[model samples]
Target chain A: MNPLIEFQGFNKFFGQHQVLADIDLKVQAGEVVVILGPSGCGKSTLLRCLNGLEEAQGGSLRLDGQELLGPDTDWRQVRQRVGMVFQSYHLFGHMSVIDNLLLGPLKVQKRERREAQAQAEALLARVGLLDKRDAFPRQLSGGQQQRIAIVRSLCMNPQVMLFDEVTAALDPEMVKEVLQVIQGLAREGMTLLIVTHEMAFARAVADRIVFMEAGRILEQNHPERFFTQPQSARAQQFLEKFSFVESLPKTLHKELS
Target chain B: MSFDTAFMLSTLPAFFKAVGVTLQVGVIAIVTSLLVALLNATILVLRTPYLWRLVKGYVELARNTPLLIQLFFVYFALPSLGLKVSGFAAAIITLTFMGGAYLTEVLRAGVEAVPRAQLESGRSIGLSEGQLLRHVILPQAGILSLPALFANFVFLLKETTVVSAVAVPEILYTTKNYIALYYKTYEMLAVLTLLCVLIFLPLSLLLRYLERRLQHGQFGH
Candidate 1:
């Protein structure tokens, strides 16, 4: 079967500086592909390129076999099929949580208010934020806000969701709730492309890991093999660095108890 | 030369009429200029190609040139070219033009200050450019711009003093005419200052109330 998402020899640049080079990756339907890389390693840029948030310099990107490059491509339609959740959870501060969710459904999709609000309320319940329906962004905690942001994207009923470090900004205690929501999506077989620093969450949720370095895919492997035995020296160094931070809380907990 | 409450009282009727004209002209200009500025700032934010050039050029011209010169062009120059506008119309149009540009620059900054993240989230939801502006950008920009816009509103009202040159007979016009006839310069100037204080103090209070309410998320009206 053809991949649900494809990046064939994709090239992206900022001015003369190349950010992503010759990216050749593919994801089957309902696959959760976690992109792992250090800051400025083009992991998030790769996800951004899929939704046309970043322009590509060369090559083709496809959503369900349709070419997304060049002038003929329509981004509005592409973006609707590929929802994105940012780290900052950019819910409209002026609006209530329900308004933020209903905006795309009623305004962009032109769905009936009753139907859209019903779907939004259902999704809010799924994310465990149904009680926050009337609260504004500032009123909610970071975990609640992130879940609402996820629900905001999910309201579009996109074929795939791109999560760019959605829980990175939350307090440590709050990160688990956001991760649990994402894990629930993975269990329900949602096609997801995530750029995240949460190594354990990535390993737990991703069916496949696409490890990147500089601007190229240095390694692509299954989670067990990738975590137990990262092939490249750079990826090994990256994992070793992350393992300390990831294991710190557990170690600290053991020491305290 | 003695302080004369009696003369101040005698000047009240003309002052009231002048205050009426000033407010009529001032409110119209402020409202229309706000609309114009919002439109121009949105255009610039959307980067609408050649239209942005027109808006940018207008902003530069309006911000740099004095309001009095702009009124002269509207009231004097336009009539010479056979487009005779009444002094009241000239005052409204010129003030709108000037405030539009000034506040466009002011509001453009506010629009730009809206977190790039907010715009990206809007796009992620597949909002059309018009929808994004209407639902996302403008609401946030409007709130962020309230203080600056109010400051500009007060400035535009004070600048309405120049309308006397075009025979609109607003506050300054009445004051000058009263001083000319009665030569009650001190009494007239004091009443003029008093009238301005009366008009503006309530407005400043309203602005403060509004800013606090919006900041606290009691958003409406």
Candidate 2:
């Protein structure tokens, strides 16, 4: 299958500081790719570049067949097809959960209110948030708010969903619920690119795991090989320092014995 | 001193007539100021190079100088330049220009208070810039701005007293006329203060109540 999104030699700078440097990556339709990295490794900036939220200074970036670097490129149109979930769960505080979900369909797609309401209801039900329809963002827990953010993006009927650490702000207990929602979305064949530190969720849900450090993809491979046998010394050292490699061997040994 | 019933009775009609002009000038000035402030604020938001500088300059000039100077400029200077407006018209124009400079800063704070995510969400929903401003930004900004705007109105009402200098027959002008004829300084000033208190107190109360109701409805109790 052809790549659904491609970033080639992408370079981004904020004044004198460079955020992303000579990065290259591709994601296929219906594929779930997870980028794992330490903080300030340009992971969020990479996602921002994909949706045209932050412009890349030099690169060839494309979504489907549309070029993102051209002078006449319509970022607004591209944003419609590319939905994003922020780490902070940026729901409209003034609007209800149902209203937040309905806004995109009604405003963007020009769907009738009744029709949009129906879709919103269905999506809310899918996200397991039907009962909280009229609740405001502040009224919900962090996990519920994140789920609402997910459904809000889904309401736009986007082709590719970019998640920038959706569960980073949630409590540990709350993290699983959000991860479960994302796992379900992955199983239903929605294309997803997640930047996260949740290795277990990535191991379970991600088709491909891409390791990033200092604005470049250090390694990319299938989840099984990437976690079990990372090719790059950086990846190996990273897994080792986290005690991830040591713990996994002990767990496997216990299972076998 | 014995109460002069006929003198007080005759003053009532004149007072009412002056009140009418006061209301007209106050309402017109407030509305004109709101429009001007909204336009000025829009220019500030756009951040266009020359236009932004021009708007800032206008705001600074209006704010730094006294209202009396602005009113005199419109009244005396404009007539010399071949635009002879009536005193009432000139007062309204001057008050609006002066009041607008202050209101722009008040309204601009409201506009800035709206979250960046809200604007992003509106754009992500495919709203055009105009639609975003009209539907999303302005409604929230208006609600957030009502308190400041009402405060400005109260100040503007007090400021309208200065129009007496331009010969507009508003409440203060009428009071001056009454004081000149009767020499009842205490009673006339007392009545003037009472009238202002009567008009503005309930308005202020009503705005407070509406503000509470809007907050409860939009943001929940």
Candidate 3:
């Protein structure tokens, strides 16, 4: 099948500093790809570029075969097919969880209030946050807010979801709940591109793992091979930094044994 | 010097009548000022080049100079240029213009306080720029800026007293007239004090309560 998203020699610059350099990557439809990287490696910038949050200075980027890098492309329209979740749970803090969920459908799609309300309620129920319908975001826990942030994007009916270190700000106890919700989405066959440091979650959910360093993809492989036999020295060094804890996937443990 | 019961009693209706004038100026000035501030702030935050500079200059000029000089310019100085602004018009204009400067700073803080992530989320959801502003940015900014905005509103209401210099028959102007006519400084001053306290104190208390509720996340209002 054709790749759902393609990045061909993409380059990004921040005032003479290159954040992304000739980055080549592809994401297939219904596939889960986790980008693991050291800090400042431009992983989050890559995700931001997909949805037009960061403009690429060079090369072709395509979503579903449509050109996304040229002047004619309306970034607003491009964004409709892309969803993003930030580390901070960027919920509309002044709005109730239900309002936050309904805003896109109501304002962007111009859906009837009742219809949007129904969708929001259903999504909230799915996430087990139904009771928070009337509660403001500040009143919710970091995990709950992140869940609401996820459902808020899902309410827009995006073709692919981009998560940038979504659980980075959550307490350790709160991380599992959010990871479970994301795993549920992956199971439902929603296309996902994630930037994360959670190795276990990445290994458990990612069909393919792309390891990036210094603004380029250093190596990529199936989760099993990536953990067991990282192809590049940088990838091996990166993996060495993480302890081989009990949570390491069985495939990797067996390969090690 | 001593209290004059009859003079105070007779002038009470005129003072009460002037309260309407004072509040009219205050209300209109408040509404117009808020609108100006919101528009100016949006332009600044959005980085509209020439317009941002223009608004920045206006805000700086208003904030730096005294309100009396601004009012005097509008009411007294403009007549030489054959632009006759009535004292009432001048008062309203000056107050709105000056208040806009202060409110713009307050609102700009609010707008900036909304983390960039919030705007990015709004954009990622396919919100247009206007939708992003209305639905995402402004509401959150308003909440963040509410306490300061509340304080500014009361401060603006009190600033309406400065219009007495331009001969607008607001509360203080009327009180001055009563002082001149009756020469009972203490009694008329007492009436003026009573009226000021009566009108402003309860509203200030009420807004303080609302602001606290907002802080506590009880946003039902």
Best by TM-score: 1
What is the lDDT, from 0 to 100, of the residue A33 in candidate 2? 93
lDDT by residue for model 2 (A1-96), tens: 669999989999999889888888889999999998878889999998887778889989989977889889877678778889988887877677
What lDDT would each prediction earn against the true structure?
Answer: 0.91, 0.86, 0.90
Task: Please write out the lDDT profile of model 1 over residues A132-229, one tens digit for every residue.
Answer: 89988888899999999999999999999999988889899999999999999999999999999988888999999999988999999999999999
The two-chain DockQ for each candidate, comma-separated, is 0.50, 0.29, 0.43
**How does chain B score by TM in each prediction?**
0.92, 0.90, 0.91
DockQ, candidate 3, vs. native dimer: 0.43
Q: What's the iRMSD of model 3?
A: 2.5
Where does candidate 2 chain A have its weakest 10-residue lDDT segment? A248-257
Q: What is the TM-score (0 to 1) of candidate 2?
A: 0.89
Compose the digit string of candidate 3's lDDT tens values, residues B58-126.
999999999999999999899999999889999999999899999999999999998888888889888
TM-score of each: 0.90, 0.89, 0.89
- The 10 consecutive residues of candidate 3 chain B with the worst lDDT sum are B212-221
The TM-score between candidate 1 and the true structure equals: 0.90
Which window of 10 residues has the lowest lDDT sum in candidate 1 chain A? A248-257
